[model samples]
Target: MTRIKKDFSLPAVFAGFITFLIGISVSSVLVIQAGQVLGANQAQISSWFWALGLSIGLSGLILSWKFKYPVATSWSTAGLALIIATGSGYNLNEAIGAFLICGIMTAVLGFFGIFQRILEFLPQSLTSAMLAGVLLKFGITLFTVMQDQLIYVLVLISTYFVSKKTLPRHSIVITLLACILLTPLFFEYTATKIHYGMTYPVWIQPEFHWSSILGLAIPLLIINMASQYLPGLAMIRSYGYKPHVNQLVSWTGIAQAIFAPFGAFSTNIAAISAAVSLDEQVHQDPAKRYIAGISCGVFYIFMGIFAATLTGLLLSFPREMITTLAAIALFATIGHNISIAFKEDLDRDAALITFLMSASGVQFLGIGSAFWGLVIGFIIYHLMRIQIKKPI
Candidate 1:
């Protein structure tokens, strides 16, 4: 593909802005939900949102500007599971300690450039399986929603598919149009008031605990590196962009290290949802893709500053609309990850184990099953290899 000259045109920024605006509310809720579960007070929780928003937004803009690529940054989704696993009981101090250690580990991995190299070593099948596991909810959730509103869902699906084939660059627009037209028919909103205002950071001092290493630090560190970092690199590579892995990882860790005490759990590359912003319908050129992410970061910072207003809007938005739109937006990626996970003959069995384990949502002790998904996959793969080689 011929390179498209870098463009920082207003249209480009606006396109990126819209994409970010769409994704910010939903993604921020997930990030905030985790912090809230940890018993982070309002001030601290607000700061978590601010910290993540600022860190991701500013870092994304600066890096994308410097590299002239559509580079985006986000916190680890795996951290969500960790908050569920070790919520409330563990003081904020321990959580900060775990965050500090994990951030250091992530920066170290990036500094040595091992993140990209590990991407090479991971078997294609296992990576695919991991993605399938991550996206299972995306594929299934849409159909469940469709059952209640067949006409609307089908209309949206048809519009999206028809547009994807006929006017690929306009597919998202078609889906979006379908959503707006159908919203009133299916939406159950009795009230709607939008708010936007600035918020302040809430800071806390870090406290170290050796126990948190085994309890929280190791699992979070492992998941962020493997699930979020590795997959994010693969995502960018799959899009045919050469990401600056070392610098990206280094800064991600530094950002988290600085913000953890304020209730930020983990920050790194985003693998799964970055597609929503980077799709050709929104951003046509690989180099210009960073513009979409940069736009998203700015919106995220806006949410950070205007925490009260955005939070209320998010709380008041119609559930069905949000669910239906999210599920539909996620369909293509769900299909892609599923195929990668189970299609290879050599790695199918191990990949299956990984997928099942991760999707099971199992928690043993205080660590989530996602971390075990990697462990179990590697174990089963090597055990089978050893068995195959042994003398009869």
Candidate 2:
């Protein structure tokens, strides 16, 4: 009892809540879109949320306690995006098969320490640039939201600015409170009736195909490693935390494989959403920040158990409001990465190219821009260095 009191704090709890809010708001739609693309029924879709929510919650809770750090995990947004983009003509069973293969591949790489070795060659600037580029859209979306709901957004923005100056540590907390209070009054949203029932996982037997394996499984694994794990570790490292990259990747893959039959697509370490709880404002002492992860874990479990009801509740809010909140939560993180990416003059041009490519949302060979951004930036960085070394 005494230990719990010393470890848990309101700020830390709120940070966890904010992390959940940002993660769900930013990416849950993609999950739904992917499910729809794969022709999943409503029950299957709900199961998807349930399985993923449970896996992510358990992973974060256990990892944070074990490592004594705020280690957060999330579904692979890039992988989901891939599904939505190219999930045509594939049955749900085949998609599940691909997911299983991807999970196994990720686990094998992690267990062998092969994944970390691949990341070792990546330059810090490229990683930072890629992160900044990935978050660029959220920041832009916040202001774009202002056009639709000017008063609502203005209120939230005003509260954020005022709280930032007066209550620096709780600025986001205050803004979130204002958002919750104002939402009911301003938005004509019908609250989804809360259903009090445990969600049952719907299991579908997997059937693998060469096309699914080649098209989905391999690409999913690549995105999970490059787009998800790389930036997630970078976020933790930026905050001075030495994450066990191998173990983190291994566990997420194992969890995904265990739950893939129930529609847990791909779970990996969180990059942007994790930053919400990882911030210094969450707590003065970094050692105690694991509370946020635990809190997030609890929330994730609850959300999963009531996946159907909560999914409706989350979707009830206007997209603009969610977008605005996401922008506010990630504002500091995006700025910090941008500064780091451009800090060294030698790496500036390569970093800029990486940032532009990532933010552009381009897809080449069915892979996301973040992976390509790293590749192009690495090449440019070396070429520039080699040219500088040559005698005139």
Candidate 3:
């Protein structure tokens, strides 16, 4: 604890704060939307915030403290998207049950070291490609929004580039500040009423059905593992962190299971936020970067305590601003992954195929493009290998 205190620095703490803000800004609305789709009332929606914030907060804190790595955790935004799309017929209780099943399955996979093994079998190029593919949508959206909000988007982009040149370490901070200053001019700003109180987690008793398990639970599990967890792990590995992958996975699953009854869908390693925490600007010494994770965890706990207020504030940001922020934050990550994906000559073609497949956003049998990208890439690599081995 003393050592942890000594390692803490203002930049690291700020980085964590920014990371938390990015995480919430990027996806809280989608989570709220998912809650509404499931017919959740106001209290249930608030419980979703409480459960997600507390679970991710505690997980990040515990993992960072134990491993001394910037092990950030976040709710599964993809899972929420899936729920909004496919969980229409399911009641809240059935959705809770599906959430529970997904958590248990995730935990089981982690306990058995399945995910780690799968990662081991994957080539670095393919994984990098997968990550790049996953992030391409955000990049596209950043420019697409410019069609409607031209001046605001231009200002945000200029601010980001200028800040990157002048103060690379605080580029995001500067960009966000610029956006905040400019937001009221371009958009209507309304402050939501803040209800100051401790948010209690509401437990919905699980009611499992075969339909929910097959349709909701399994798909949610697959999406989290392929689209979220895999990319997150790739980011961690790419940044040269040798995390206890199994422990991280297992613990997130455990945390989700514990909080699922409270409307928490799924929690997993955070790819975008984790990248923000790992930035060199956060801490010169990579060894001390765990302090950022700790700081983020502390902030998450605070967010959970005032879930209602924070949710309102997070929702107050306009869609374009949020999307732009997310795009800027992820820009470096996308570039790094793309570079890594095509670095090697032999794997270049396979990696590109994987990247295109992932970016295509194609889904089959309820699984996302990320999984299919990996599969197709692996098959292509093997085919190339077989061709090389055969007589010409």
Better of 1 and 2 by lDDT: 2
| Residue 238 of model 2, lDDT score | 73
TM-score of 1: 0.82
Candidate 1: list runs displaced more than 4 Å: 1-39, 191-195, 338-392
Against the reference, the lDDT scores of all candidates come to 0.70, 0.85, 0.86
| lDDT value, candidate 2, whole model | 0.85
Pairs that collide, model 2: none
Once fitted onto the true fold, the runs of candidate 2 whose alpha carbons sit more than 4 angstroms away are: 1-4, 387-392
Clash pairs (backbone) in predicted model 1: 70-289, 70-290, 128-341, 129-341, 195-309, 197-306, 198-305, 199-305
Cα deviation at 302, candidate 3, in Å, is 2.3
Candidate 2 versus truth, CA RMSD in Å, comes to 2.0
Which digits, one per residue and each the tens of the lDDT, describe model 1 over residues 1-392? Answer: 12324454443454455445444545666766666776677778888777777776777667766776666677766577676657565777777778888888878888898876766666656665666676676667778888888887888888888988987766766677678788877777765476456888887777788777677888788778766777676666555567788998888887777777776677777766665655555656655666666766777677667866776666666666667776766676666666766776767789889888867767665455655675788777776667455688
Candidate 3 per-residue C-alpha lDDT over 1-392 given as tens digits, one digit per residue, 9 for 90 to 100: 79987897876787788778877887788988999999999888989889888989999999989998798888877788889999798999999999999999999999999999988988889988988888899899998999989989998999989988888767877887888899889988787876778888887999999999999999899889887788788878887788788999999999999999998799899876777787676776889988889889888888887899877777787888778877887788789889999998989889999999989988887678888998999998777777555577
Q: What is the model-wide C-alpha lDDT for candidate 1?
A: 0.70
TM-score of each: 0.82, 0.93, 0.92
lDDT of 2 by residue, 285-319 (tens): 88888889888887888878888778777877777
